[model samples]
Target: MIRLKAFPILAAALVASLALTACGKDAAPAGPKLALDAPLPETIPAGTKLVIGDPTTQRVVELNGWDKDLPFQIEWAQISGGPAVTEAFHAKALDVGSAANIPPIHAIWVGIPVKMIAVRLRKDHVNFPLFELGIAPKAGIKSLADLRGKKIAYSPGQVQGEVVLRTLAAVGLTQKDVTLVELPSTGDVYPNALVSGLVDVAPLGAGVATKRYLDNYARDGAQVLRHPPYRDDLTNLYVRAETLHDPAKAAALRAYVKLWARAVEWQATHKAEWRDAYYVRQEGLSPEDAEFVVRAAGDPVIPRDWTEAIGMQQSSIDFLAKEGGQKRFDAAEIFDRRFEALAAEAAPKIAVGPAPAQTEGKTNP
Candidate 1:
């Protein structure tokens, strides 16, 4: 069972405050030059702070790219979860951060003011599917149908919860058929709740699922109840709408996407190297487990036609509306594709394709 560590709330609050204060000040002294083989811009604009969330999980691209010696200084900060990252974005404490599809959509429903620029990873394969299902051995929960009448736990506003709910509907089950437990956070504790029998099922990332399986904490004993038919799970880079409106910041935003694209290309070519060294070594996963996890992560690069790639956001919006989580809202209005278009215009030589829609089931239960 995963133990829930007592998070130092005061410490985290202080750290976030200090980091925001630092960004408000003048630029820091020049540090050692970055060693990078990829082409980098000659000058980064002054007062530019690439405030990133956690390195290993949240900002996987930035963390891995740093090892390849990519140019640019990234100010890494630790955030609690999607909600914290969203809060930071609102406070101007973050420039780029990672969040699930739901919070950002909720933000737009309430006018929180952010623009999603690109998609980072896709999850439709075995690893990602197994990870989110949160099946347990002793529970005898073999499929989505078995979850009926069971108490299932998940973070209320997290992407995994939405996936769980949608997965159940795919198998003709609804939230009413099962007891839904709202988790306080999407971190380690939610997984522990499953192992300890507090909840029959929980949602987790591929990496965490792999680790638990390898440790005998959870095994093939549980089955993946349902998998998202769409190949890409929307995980993208977002900036304040205000930031995107400014011409200077907008230019920088385009540059950031270009750099991100280059980094994704590098990750694809050197998959094994990154999987072994950075993903395994830094995250402290076993080599075998790491391989499974990396394979599950798919490509870290954003597709050239990101707007089309992230069309799943529309389906999610539809689901939320039906579930009463969101009132009627235009999917096109919530998603701003101008920056992605700008990135494509600048890198016209890159091959891009229509975003694939792999829907398999209905949203209604």
Candidate 2:
């Protein structure tokens, strides 16, 4: 049950595993020096293979029949989030992995070279945030200012931890102003912590967890509050630097990026089918919950440009580094822009409209 925001703490074991393997394959013969600006090869050579670790995209690709007629072989690894993906990279077990902006930064900090190959942002992201601040019943927390002297759940390595830091900053309060109850944000840990009064507030992810927390405890005065509008929806497809150095895998990755973009587009265009096939059928969520998950996601936007994304990433790196007492470096160092345009070119354009006023859920209140 490793969650999205726990990579930093879990990464202590990474250095020990680096010498294990490289993409679970024999090291490829060294090829021509790979310059950052080198154009992607036009063709994926026969026998090219990639062990991708994107479970959600895998579901979408399979459901839309987009997994067919590929030039190279794909061995999909059911991996997501930072902890597992980072460990896989350390073990050389993954070629391409999907995660938020934090993992790539953590990888750089921990001396594991990796690069983000593609990026995705939520349209109308302000309203459809990835997380919300959940207040424990009887904690008597009403606003960010009320957080003083209250116990807050913190996972320094995960995005939830980032949210906590950002939330504190919004109120002009530092970590010392409140009690940080260090808790791993995995499965129901945060919710359980709040329910048991172990923490006064915790950042709950938007979909199922937020919905259920409110539904089951609203009678006891449980409440969900919106954090300040900040960009927390930086999802990307990244790979270890060594993987891109191999000619065969690089070619396969180029091809896979295009298909990956199309799969994202497929999910956006065919929401009902995606909800049924992925959220309901595969994830075991009810029809109503599946629909809510899809709606809460708003629209997915794969930008042709990386300017704004890199800026957001840099901001996150600076914030996390300051909060966690880690080294600060230029965020641009972790991005490989060669494949930046691939996703935008492959996917159909969707207009990003204004944020909605409301949605059908108790969590919204």
Candidate 3:
């Protein structure tokens, strides 16, 4: 079976096919010119759309609000995963999309003309860890070693699965030691799978894991893994390098990032609003689960400092090449940081506060 990370290449090919059918040689009408000095308009240029994947979550809700606050028309297309979003990007159907660290690397390695424009969120930003090994309560599993011969579920291309594999390796287990089942996002059906005994163990995000714990499907579970430190780089917002070169899209991207930073700050200040609006109403998640998601989002993180982010990317690339049998791709060649620099410069001037004092035994949000 082809790996999940490799799906973007296939998705991109599909996108190319779609793009060829959508546009003719006639020049498309242009959007309004950006006015950097003036306040961003509440609606973007008419006929402009922004396609996103699985955007019903709290983060997307916040982003959608930001879109309304912008100066132009913003249309959103909700797909399933990063690969589909990538396909949209390839087809020119999407202006921006959220992606984990790996698939973008895969796209870049394949010579796709994309650049990381903004940092969205990081796994480590949360006070508690995001990814963890979850064992079914009925399985009598107590530790990673106990998972031997048990079935495990994870999405192949996702960072959670990467964490699971690394954790297994850390504990001296291999794929042979546990049966690996490739699922979509753990938030989708892994909880039901666990409750129904379809899978013995799985790696899951904190929100879903919290829900499962609250639902009583899993018990005495320990975090057999954490997001690998190497993967701490931002899950970025990407645009085509060609788009960045366009003065309109480039300026819009900068404005978008500025709005994004404000959105993050807004979420931090009004956590309760986001919790009620999205997690409770939309996701039907419990209060505890919602709180976990909110606090996890409060890590005061931004995607500035591309050189440092690139160092983190290099570590992940090296690990993927060695352990994942991925080709040795040059990290610098794959990552275009110019957009990040531009966005950082264009962002609003917020007061830089002192770093939070670390307390003993404090785990990240």
The local distance difference test score of each candidate is 0.57, 0.77, 0.55
Residue 214 lDDT in model 2?
A: 90
TM-score of each: 0.75, 0.86, 0.73
lDDT of 2 at 7: 44
Which 10 residues in a row give candidate 3 its minimum summed lDDT?
A: 356-365
Model 2 agreement with the true structure over 1-365: per-residue lDDT tens digits: 11223344343354334325333463753567555456666666677778788888888777767778888888777667776777777777778889777778877777788888888998878988988999999899888779899999987656777888899889888888899887867668888999999999999988778988998898999999999878889899999887777767777887788888888888889999989888888889899988988898888888766778889998998888888878898887777777766677678564232322321110100
Order of all candidates by lDDT, from best down to worst? Answer: 2, 1, 3
> How good is model 1 by TM-score?
0.75
Selected candidate, larger lDDT, 1 vs 3 = 1
Question: All candidates: CA RMSD in angstroms?
Answer: 8.6, 7.7, 7.8
Per-candidate clashes come to: 0, 3, 14
lDDT of 2: 0.77
lDDT of 3 by residue, 1-365 (tens): 22544344434554565466446311333654433222323334434333334254326445455554555444444443555665675566666666666656656544556665555554355445555566666777765567678888865555656666776677788877778877765234666666667887766665556555545643444223344333433566666555543344544555566555665556555678879877788779778778877775544355445555666667777765666666775666544443444334433343132322431111212
The alpha-carbon deviation from the true structure for residue 178 of candidate 1, after best TM-score superposition, in angstroms, is: 1.5
